[model samples]
Target: MTTNNIDILGLAEINVNKNMLRILEHMVQDKFKLYFTTEGKKGTGIRFLVKKEFAVYVQQFQHFEGRIGFIDFYTKKKKIRIIQAYINVQDKEKPQVKRLYKQIEHWTNQCLNSFVKDIIIMGDFNTKWNEYEFLDISHWRHDIFNYFKKHFIKESTLVFCDDISDMYTYIPNNPNHSHNKIDYIWCNIDLMLSAIDSKPRDVQPVIKTDHRMITLDLFMDDIVINKNNTQKCQPSSKTIYCYDEMQKTDGEWNWDKFNKDIIEYLDNPNIKLTTNKIRGINSHKQLNQLWNLFRKAIIHSAKCNIKQKKMKVKQNCHPLYDSDLKRDLNMLKGMLNKIHGTKLDFNDRSIENRQKIIAHITALYRRSDGNKSNTLSDFISITKRHNIIISNHFLHNKTFQYKDILQDTIIILESKYINATYEYKKNIMNTFIQERNQNYKTDKKKMIKSVLEQPHTSLSIDKVYKNDNNKDTFYTEENEVKEQTNLHFQMIVSAINCEKDLSQHPKWQDQYQSKHDVQHTIYSDLMK
Candidate 1:
């Protein structure tokens, strides 16, 4: 990376287990600072190597084990966040792989809630390069890419810059051997201005490596506002955890048919048992030891037999507001309005006015920022009280005006309003999130009901046969194999598109009953 003058490098599929991954993380270097999959991980490993100069600006580091992660850097009044991912090689149709895509989507959701404007995601996505077109609906519209279609990712758009290329990252030793361009670099609208180009590095000796390095060059000065002249917002750190191994117990557990399922989970050799210090379980030393052993057995079996979900707990900072945050956000919004109304021609174009608007936004971001309960989600989203999807990009081109100052500002702030009818897009987005969570909490089984009621036929075969890290699945042909995915869905996830256990799928219900006929529901007797 240093030889290539690369300041930041992302390495995916490091091909090491958790123990080895931990060892590599400890083996530090002088020149480059590393961010590894410390928590919330799966698969192999993904890491980031940042030159010391840039590494000093790193505000936070996070990742999803062997799959994806990101590093946040604050420099020159701009936040340059790099999200690195290793999309594993697997059948896309499985529910487990879909979990990976959903996890990516979840990570992107975090990006939107951020106060920082420039976000870049780069890594080996494992997209079927030759099988798809850059602009084809099948490619971006597919559940794989999800929301990336709206923003410039691998392809260039009139609004954003991307170095279009047909170069492949996977090269074979023999020239006749097949290869593919599976790696990609994506930037948000703000970073698009600084994106010089993204392309594959020169093909190296195929015997030395199968995958070539990909790089993106950015004109940092172009995107950054002078930090000396700008007021900085106190950055919020979003905590990361590895919950992918935890089971999702939303759907009812079928005790009658769970005998063989529980046995399979318990018998699996890969089940890792760790002894952590416990409290309040039992006072006696012997009983405490016995209780811990029993608890471990139960949890290990549940994780293997039931569905598991890998997720990053979202940071909610609204509670940090001391009645002052709300007032400050309103004041910031009004100040932004005054700038446009006072001067029609020069207001939006003037760098001073733009800087003031940025300051106001940052002020709101830092309001009551007593370093408590804050997170990386864009503060704009939660500062408001209402459900709306976050809106379009702001400041795409020269002079950074979207159609004009008023329209551009509205695009960023007015997602909640239908036809400019009401409020900030952030508020609207937060409203939706809150509503979804409330609904899920009110009815844990609602997701199961919704999943069962939905028209399964309407969904494509790929959608119906989903992938998840559960052993009870029966929809696919590869049932006998031991498969694991570094992803799990929550209650809202199940409501959206959660797969049912083989015993619960509507079509197989009748046939599986006979499979269920001989089995009986076993209950633990508390009275005894």
Candidate 2:
């Protein structure tokens, strides 16, 4: 009943609310039937909201293709038909828009040819009337405008408007913005005249909403003449029944073909076999139970190992570990470990496992390279070699036997090896350090143990040396000087803590001392 020309960005920001519902309620009356169309990423979609009483009778709803939102609502009223439509705009310069208009025209004409007696088309037409004065007519695409005008006045009967005061439904609210009169309500001529004969009132404009409410008051007495005057509906009952039967049969046939193809593919020796063949037949509840059990087993195993390492580090039993360092290592392992049993299965494994591996690899690659330029395709190719190994083993199972299976397996393995050797080498090097604790040497191990035994303070010489091998005699001497300067800083900090009033503390003296010694020490030793 109400249609506004909504700016795309503004529309995105606004949340759907009770106010929107209130507007819709005023438009659709007693039947409580509402149909709405909106544009989304995939294109336009139409939804119907019928009151529960009428829902059982409402058969089908469809949106026309190639148009932004050309919706058709088909309903049977006392064995008669009615269709409500919302057509799209045609922009001349865009061939695609013009093509959509042609499609709507063809579709509308076909619908009019059918048995549908009552048709109501409403919405923003995105065209201007003579009274509208914002946009220049010379600059406007006249050809497209003319086509719509011709179709509107000639093909359909226009509903009379009582109030024509405000034609501009959409005001951009900017001084430089263009304005136009583009909204309308139209009905079939035959239906309009019959309703008009009963002395229907002019359409009234609803407040707040832009579009005016158009109503046709129908009398029961007038139906007697309309019944006798009804044209022979083009689609006979037999023809409609046959069309429906064919559609049902076609759907069944397509489903059967799809099932057969799936079965053949599962049984084939050439394609890599998977447990999906068995799992696909099981009920969803059963599959979920198995999936959950597998996930728990894998997660428990990974967590147990992580917890043991943390306990060892906390007890000062492992000299190689720091609490913070152990936490990070456990976190990384937890992230890489696959928790779901469903993820390890051969068929579902490809997509889920691939995503997990990609995420892991991408994070590592970014950390190493300082950018995301590393190709995921190279990593994916490497993983495919593992897939080939699984595939060869699956084909050699007793259930599958093809004469050329071994030959095909050999060819696949050779191709995988050629593509993935460099990638495999890189993956091995990166994962090798975590595979075993290779960084812990005897001296370094002792250093970590010494640091953990003492209470937390500024990092000691031994603690820093455990992590950094470049620190030799010169580095240690410089660090010792830095450590002594830090002790002097701690004494000054302790003196400041004793003063209740900040002003009582010698601010000038403290500032002068800090500047004289601290700055001099930092610049003379470190900078030089």
Candidate 3:
């Protein structure tokens, strides 16, 4: 029976910080059979109030936060489905307001699913009709009006109040703004006809709220007449018109169940997870941790590469240059050859070799510096020679190209390595914890004794080397020692391999080589 489109904004302002509670109070005071709010955050704040009579058979209620200020309420009304809501203004070109308008359109489009019956959309639409019988507005407003037209939501004022003298349902409180008809109540034509007899009188209520409250009444005359005539009709032959109001239907759709099903499908190790499944939890802590580690590795590798380059520069600028620098020159040339057009081959071995060579050269230069008799020219000559080698290598292979290829390849390799390492580390950590837990359970007494035992310095050799004639204890001790050693070795090997793999990764070549003129040109154009 409730048909008035209430201005929740006015209610919100009155309650201010206590908006939710205040709205609840208002619904109670007005004896609202059903209620909804657009101000709710993510639909959590939305509340639905039902009269006691109606609440009994009301199986479930559902609401969705739609575009703009819109919230769609779905309810089982006497077993018949109904959708109710207000729409926000759609003005998509005005810099500050386009986003809100687009959101409304999105919601409207989503609501086009056919299951909802008796769709009644009513609210304060801060807009005017496109083809007005009297006034003209901007083209953008007309465009918005056309959008509604396309959606088949006819202008409510034009359809319902065309014959009325005072067609306007809204009054501008501000003197500067124009007075226009902006409020409306709209429904499908068939539903509108069915409720014609119950229409409310046109005397708008001037409550504490700013906007005038209008209402539509739904008459139950047919229902009353049928009930009265039921005395003469046989119970078996009688048709039940109000039975829908007494029956309960299915509950509202559970989106959480759907989400849970999706997550299970993806996280199930037995089942193969797809790309679509992974996209669901983008900001999950586990995935974020992996990504963070990968990012850090990339940054560390880049820093190492940069440091090597800087060192090479310094070496080139050294004053004491070798007259027969051909040996050093050949080494540099050979390194460049291995790297040329091979961006993806720099694994642990290559990285270790590069680092070792850089360290050796740096140490030599440092030793030379420590010698008091060494002059600035000695350092400058050495540095200049190295620089020449590097410069030549850069020019010959087209420095930009190789550098780009190397950078890209390194990034890709690092990301893959990080992902693999994360899983490996997780597994190892879990195993270690499990083993410790098992030891605590099986050998609690011995573990305690070991902790309380005298220090190795204080213990006599005889006590330390006591022969455990008991086979079980000796076997247990041996197995424990072997297990501990194996675990330690595994940890050491994993750590070493991880470091070696990362250092030797040839990903930088891909990044380095791809930065050449040809690639750069293409990249620049794409960016533009």
The prediction achieving the highest TM-score against the true structure is 1
Instruction: Note each model's CA RMSD in angstroms.
Output: 30.7, 36.5, 39.0
Predicted candidate 1 versus true structure: per-residue lDDT over 159-205, tens digit per residue:
23233344678766789877877777777654564566666677465
Model 1, residue 67: C-alpha shift (Å): 1.0
Residue 95 in candidate 1, Cα distance off native in Å? 2.4
Clash count of each predicted structure:
24, 0, 53
Candidate 1 vs candidate 3: which has greater TM-score? 1
TM-score of each: 0.41, 0.28, 0.32
By TM-score rank, best first, the candidates go 1, 3, 2
The segments of candidate 3 whose C-alpha lies over 4 angstroms from its true place after superposition are 1-15, 19-23, 26-50, 55-112, 130-138, 141-145, 155-157, 174-178, 197-206, 219-528
lDDT tens string, model 2, 1-528?
Answer: 223311010011112454575586576546456544443324233434555344444454445541223334333322122333333344443565566556545655554433233344444445555433334555332443454445442222123443344444444557687654455444444344334421112233533443332334434333333445566744322211122122212553333443444455445463433577454646888667655655554454333322221112222343222332333323322222322222333234355655553453344334354654332233233335345333323322421222133234333443443345436556776765443344355456545655466655565442222223664432346666576555556667465424355455788556534465455657557544
Q: Candidate 2: give its CA RMSD in angstroms.
A: 36.5
CA lDDT of every candidate: 0.55, 0.40, 0.41
Candidate 2 pairs with clashing backbones: none
Which candidate leads the pack in lDDT? 1
Q: Which tens-of-lDDT digit does each residue in 156-266 have in candidate 3?
A: 445445453455555667878755565545544323433532222343353444454334434333112333445553233322222222212323333343344445444
